[model samples]
Target: MKKAILYLVDEAGVIQGVQLSAELWKKAEKVVLPLLEEPESQELQREGPLKDFQTLMEYWDFTYPYSPRVRCPHCGASCEDWRTDEKHTFILNTANLGGLLVFHCTRCGTTIRHKHFKDHMSIEHTIPAKYKKS
Candidate 1:
């Protein structure tokens, strides 16, 4: 009987796999089929909330339609009391600003702005209004 191979490759191009007899491959496929059809969100839920620094840094570039979990970078406070300010920039009868979503953290009064781009966004941090920068 012929055999089937299942290969798993990582980002670094390392590969691993198993070659199984036709009969065993059928059984393995039955077990792996259900997992392949599972929703991606279900898998992410099992991993819990992602708190990696790179994830947070890439928040503005998130392709998901929903808002990401945002917290005060300084005080680590929740988003409940944060104030949102959407700024539109205009230049001599032309609107140049794509969009800016500014979240003012109430706990520590830090201002964070996410600038919208054509396909993604960029984040900016500003000093508290009360503090003077020399």
Candidate 2:
């Protein structure tokens, strides 16, 4: 089953606007009200997931040598190491000890998911509907 069909993400993420289902909205109103009261900057500036990224490196089990290059599949934007990009082209979305790191491309609305394995690292992406080309 899809996990998050309750809230709309676009119009955007983290989020420019939120469209919640009536049932869920009614229940969530209590929790969501306080969150809205002390509103903060929509864009949370993170220096990158330094500690978690380091932990993933330390436990590297991939066959190839460790490299930090991250490229957006939807757009041609590539970075040698996303964590150190001065332009901030990608934001770390998720990372875990399970060897999966998800990054959101700043140049395009595509999500880059890197799954590290013992033999190699598997990479994949999900582009937002608005950016889908014919």
Best-fitting candidate, scored by TM-score: 2
Model 2 clash pairs are: none
Candidate 2 structure quality by residue, lDDT tens digits, 38-132: 42223443645656777877887778886679998887888998767887777787777788888887767588999988878889999988877
Error of 2 at 69 (Å): 0.5
User: How many clashes in each structure?
Assistant: 0, 0
Instruction: Evaluate model 1: give its TM-score.
Output: 0.33
The C-alpha RMSD of each candidate to the native structure, in angstroms, is 18.6, 12.5
- TM-score per prediction, in order, is 0.33, 0.61
Q: What's the lDDT for all of these models?
A: 0.45, 0.75
lDDT of 1 by residue, 1-134 (tens): 44355667778877855557678768888897787544222211111112232244455344544343355565555542221322111001111233455555443556666565656767666666566556
RMSD of candidate 2 to the truth, in angstroms, is 12.5
Candidate 1 error regions (>4 Å): 1-68, 80-97, 129-134
